[model samples]
Target chain A: MTNPIVLDVNNLAVSFQTFEGDVKAVRGVSFQLKKGETLAIVGESGSGKSVSTKAINRLLPVKNTLIESGEILFEGKDLLQLSEKDMQKVRGNDIAMIFQDPMTSLNPTMKVGKQIAEPLIAHIGLSKEKAKARAIELMDLVGIRNPNEAYKRYPHQFSGGMRQRVMIAIALACEPKILIADEPTTALDVTIQAQILDLMNKLKKELDTSIIFITHDLGVVAQMADRVAVMYAGQIVEVGTADEIFYNPMHPYTWGLLASMPTLEVGKKQLYTIPGSPPNLLHPVKGDAFAPRNDYALGIDFVEEPDLFQVTETHYAKTWLLHPDAPSVIPPEEVRRRKEKYQTVRMGKACGERIGGGAIGSGG
Target chain B: MKKYIAKRLLTAIPVLLMISIAAFIMINLAPGDPTNLYVMPDATPEQMEATRRALGLDQSYPVQYMRWLTRALRGDLGISYSTRYPVLPILVSRIGPTVALMGTTLLVSYIIAIPLGIISARKQGTWVDTLLTGGAFIGVSIPNFFLGLGLIYIFAVQLKWFPTGGMLELGGNASILSVLHHLVLPVAVLSTFYIANMTRYVRSTMIDVYGENYIRTATAKGLTKQVILTRHGIRNALIPIITIIGTDLPRLVGGAIVTEQIFQWPGLGRLTILAINQREYPMLMAITLLSAVVVLLVNLLVDMMYAVVDPRIKYD
Candidate 1:
């Protein structure tokens, strides 16, 4: 049986009031997080991945941002119906969010220890001494050396990776049920990115915390995500388990995203990039937002929005190409080859596991 | 920190010396000798020459500056040419009223500005914000001399609520309460620009601080609005506000020149103007040097305050 749902967001829409007009940032987006699962929402910039997660925590600015519609149900209760006082209790206690830029996210004037201890004091109701002790412990947990000494230092003293580590430590302080990491490793270099991802993976197992990971990097999604959601223009165009999304992506937007990522494996000479910028949100689209960009666009795709079409019990894709009457079109050869390669690697690993076990048994 | 402060103090010595040299040269270059104001027009040429000799006015500029510099180095600013009294004593007596007026105005302006700025920023795009913005614009635009006179007309002449001008009535009781009573109009007049400046600065800074990513981080930490604002918002915004206040310190003393002249308040500003009017070379030089010193000291203090407020800013 699958893990139980911890947080469920349904048909959530968010709009930002700018001087020009009301920009509908997120529209009719729905998703659910399971306990201890890492659900990575992968999309390009301006795809509303970050905005969707920010809306979950009510972190959006109240002055100019308006929650247009929809229910954010955490546990059984609707989070949207809760008061600010009640939201505060749920925010750092039940859910915590880590931001993209570690440099800008941490307060420069405050000690890293105090910053880490903030959530503990606010949500866990820990005394200063106890919170500080826990903060140091968290620092050590995130692999910061001499965490006790490092705790007293300001944010500038730490390197970029170390600062990101501190950010993770702060988020993990309260041991919340859900952790929302919004492009957490995007600002770091490749090596540091791997280290942070590894640390987060370890923490997920240790804490059994569900993570909603938002990223534009498909490579990061491959490593860290259990489930993947491909968002395009404020909507999830495809949702499935990691294997299904990678090995058998159905939506044209998902194909564009995957086609764009560089791989060591042989592919086309030039990188495939989606043509045209995202549509301006000042004026909402009438039909499929990606219809203009899709190379395999059906005539009906431009006039009507397609709902999620079920491919498997756990996989779904929103595209007109999935219709029964639509002409058959094969995935690009490079994507097919990559899928085959992934299958071969997995089969080889399984085969090796059994042979190694048998060889050990015979030797014994 | 001690080393930083010591180094700053060391640097100030040369700065003050340069200021003294500049002030001495500028005052001496100006026309209208102090002897002209002191002597009678009908006095004999011999009498005028004798008076000039006694005052050392006939000496070379270098010779006179060197003499004054030597006395100043020994903590004496020399005797005033216009009054013939010791310059230090006259300055010592006059500085108190200026300090009280400026200090109270500074305190009141900050006390009023900080809250209004915060509230204005919080209530941005609201009627309250618009009203405060309108008020700040008006406060910044009004000429202090005109405002002082207008206040005198309304409160002193029309309503008879306050004394028109001066720190105190001649021969009035020298109690602190009575001094404050006399201070009402002048303080209000002096504070207008400060309030206007500080409130606008603080409002912009607070709004900018509110947009900082750390504020979102603070909010994500489940902090109350009050805690987030005080701990994150105001703390960071305070850096720029302190800067504005610090750079405004020299102006605080200098801007008082016009206001002091209009009210005839017995302060260094009025004294400086009087020295200029009467060609009190020694007194003018002394006041200019003192103003420069105040500016340098305030800059040092502001730098120290930066290290205190921002942990990332180390004095090393």
Candidate 2:
């Protein structure tokens, strides 16, 4: 049997030495991704989603960061142990990342074609003419119309969606095994977000590239994730297939997230909201990090921490409620109402798959 | 671009106008007249009054200003009260040494500071960074006179490598080579401050640019670290560096009085001092006005460089 895991991140913990004190950013966060899977890490700001990915790239400054413990074994090599010189080779060859703000991530003075060709020259050793030709091909693959003309244009000359396409083109330049997209569509308009999502889905299926998508929008998680890992206070609180998380959430934080998602509930007077803020990781709790924000906290939640309890073969939850002796609790009524909305999503995907089963083979 | 130039030039007018007014008022407002400067100490009051009338100081303040402004526009800085030579030629002759010395020093300092600053920001808190930053602090804290004396002690007094004072020996014909020898100490004195301060600015700007996401993206794209620095960081850093040089050029071009005094370089600073001691108001006003104009022109040059660094900038 083939080994199922493509990335094995075991007990990874990270901290930052700030002026006030040492802020423990990521506390023993762990997860795994299989080949050709999309694992969406959903969290509020400072949940360590970005930091964990940056650690994978080894991009955090050494002066401030301390990766206290853990291992990130990609293809069985510890990424943290590699020197910066070696890391440069891994960055574009094995793992590549695309940032949220496309405008700031692209060098304002460089041509779009040249930016895309940079990785090809670095990793693939392509000459100027060959790189240019391949850059045009990548642009065409990303669905930029008239790719030949687009090659001569600079970044500022492109529209917002088009700029992101250039960024996507640059990330896909070397065709790495894994792609990390951090809020790729957060800055885009509503309509553009859908198109970019579709593009990413199509690209992932075509390239067979395992993507770790970092986002806070649950709707995006539903649309794009093969599996969802809900993160809070730098730890994974829930992990399951997208169907499991949206249709049948097992964690209180996951319930809160589902309830607060703004959608087409037209006549509702007020949108549901999660009561308290995400825990401040600078000074985290002794027991459960989400307990203060969670309303259904049991007595044990204040004194002892929760561990990941298996819900199904593919699902897990880190909550005291999952214990055999604990009182049974249900996700709030609003989450039950939201379940009907996701039923429509499953129907739409099922219809899409039945209409063109062969088309699903190539996402385009 | 036209809007930017027009706005900048319009702002500069009032500044130059104020400089002219201040130079005008202060030169005439000083105690004692140029009359006593030309006369012997034993001269009678009538003789002093007569000398003052001959030089047109007896005219009304408004009249003195008009006559002064007219000759100033024509480039006739009045004759120096001390040497009785045309102030313009004395200034003109000395311009070569001052420009050469200040120009060479500023150029060399930038050449050293930019690369050093980029390296420092790249290495950031390493031993080399610590040592350079500490050295820059020492360069900034030590007084110009002391630094000058120390350098003279090293190269002149101790090693006997360069001349102690003057651009060339007193009787020797000035050549480019002879001129270079005299430039070493005074230029070194003046540049110690510019280099020290600019490196701090360069370091800060480099750090800021390096922190920008585009730089991280550049590294990820597999551009070598040096390419990331010189190609990306330095071009962005140039805006602030150029601004400093432009804003500070007047002081450099005119030459600092203290630094000029130490080395006895025949630059604008020494001429201003000589004019002041003899109370030559017209010559003083002219030199001050010229310095202000040169500074304004340099400001314009710096504005032009901004668009070159980041072409996204546009003026409506």
Candidate 3:
């Protein structure tokens, strides 16, 4: 049987009121998180990947933040319409979040064990003693050795990687149905990033928890994502299965994202970069937001925004090049090379042999 | 912790020694002589010389300082040049009143300021915040002596609701109620400045703390606003607030100098002024040393409090 959908976000729009004007941070974004699967939203900075997920849990700042339009559906209830009092019941209990910066995410003054126990005591009405017992168990589950000894220590006593594990322990303390991790490993070193990613992958299977992993790291996306959604300028430009997005990316933006990944080649002169900065969100855009940056921009791309065109039963892309009437443009040679390399790695994995390189490193 | 305290105390010795040397040199260099207070203007130079010899001012600076230091180390601060009694006892008697006044003012100001600061920070940019911020500016700007006189004139002279000055009613029985009656005006004047200062400090510190990532984490944990504020906001804000409180400890004596002068309160501040005017070098030296020691100990206490409040700050 197919896994059920746990979270359905429809047409979500979020904005921030600043001195200049309203900043449309997230403009009409939508995605689904299926139960027991990992959905990775990949983008560059300011692509609104983080904002869309934070809006799901209602974790955006109260002041100056306006959710202009959206519906976050969880368990047949529109979370947007729920009062803050009811929303509290959902946060950290039904849905938990782990932030990017581990050093600052956990309260420095409070003990790590107490922090993990906070949600248990708040939502489940567990007694202090019972919560402490459960918290120690969670610490052990997150691979914290000597959980009893580490319980009394503060966040400052732990290293960056250890603090992130503590954050994960806190997020998973209440057995949340959906865990939104906002770049959870971006701040960690490469080796530590792999370990945290591995821990998350292992825990997701053990607990059967759905996850919305937001990051700009494609290597991490390759390792952790079951489904991938490529966001550009606060909109999902392309989305498909992990294999489809990495091996057969359709949108020019997705092509740039994959081509930008540093390959293990002997004499590649420089990495390909998408030219031009992202469009400023202070003012509304009349047509396609990425037209100026796209080298394959058609005349209509600058005058009219393209809707998502169906490429396959499971894949969709928002680019005019996929139109039947449009001329077929060839993707760059680097894009073709990456797909071939990834296919070879996949074949190696099937034969019980491991291949290590960029973009497809440590495939889960 | 014990080792930290001992190290702090050891370091304070050199600081105290430096302050003492500076005070002795400055006092001796001033344009006045102790013998001038004793002898008549028409007296012969030999009579003045004899008075200086008896007071040991005839000796060199080092000899005089060494003699005073030796006696001071023995807990004998010498007889006051003005009062003719021992300096330490007079100081001891005055300590009770100053402590009572300062302690009450600190308690009252914190009681008023903490809530006001939290409210001002919570309701930032609202009318309540604007009003408190404006009032704090005025309170901080207005001199304490002026505020004290204004309070005495309004509440004491015209309104006649509370006693004008002193720690108790004149020739009346020394009861708690009577002392409280007299404490009203001085406490009001002194605490106004403290409340204004602390309210602004707590407001800004709390505003910064509210923006910390931990607060967002607290919110994500589904904590109510009240719990988030008390548990996460205030506790983190308290680290900087404690620092300001420690720095303000020296202001107890500094603020009291002018406040006590206006209120005619029987405190060391008034005694200090009297000693300075009459050139009671022995009494002045004793009070200065006491203040220096108090300041050093207060700094040490503040350091200890840092360890208690923030786990990141481990003394050991």
Q: Score the docking of each candidate (DockQ).
A: 0.80, 0.53, 0.67
Model 2 alpha-carbon miss at residue A63, Å:
1.5
Winning model by lDDT? 3
Residue-level lDDT of model 2, residues A121-216, one tens digit each, is 888999999999999999999989999998987778898899889889988999988999999999999788889999999999999899999999
Which residue pairs come into collision in candidate 2? none
True contacts kept of each: 0.73, 0.48, 0.62
Q: Per-residue lDDT for B172-252 in model 1, tens only?
A: 778888889988888899889889888899999999999899999988888899989988899899899889989877755
Q: How many backbone clashes does candidate 1 have?
A: 0
CAPRI category for model 2 = medium
lDDT of each: 0.86, 0.82, 0.88
Tens-place lDDT digits, model 2, residues B228-275: 776777876787788888866777668777778778888877877877
Per-candidate chain B TM: 0.95, 0.91, 0.97
RMSD of each: 4.1, 4.0, 2.7
Write down the TM-score for model 2. 0.90
Cα lDDT over the full model 3: 0.88
Q: In model 1, state the lDDT of residue A233.
A: 85
Which residue pairs clash in candidate 1? none
Ranked by TM-score from best down, the candidates are 3, 1, 2
Who is ahead in TM-score, 1 or 2? Answer: 1
- Residue A335, model 3: lDDT of 77
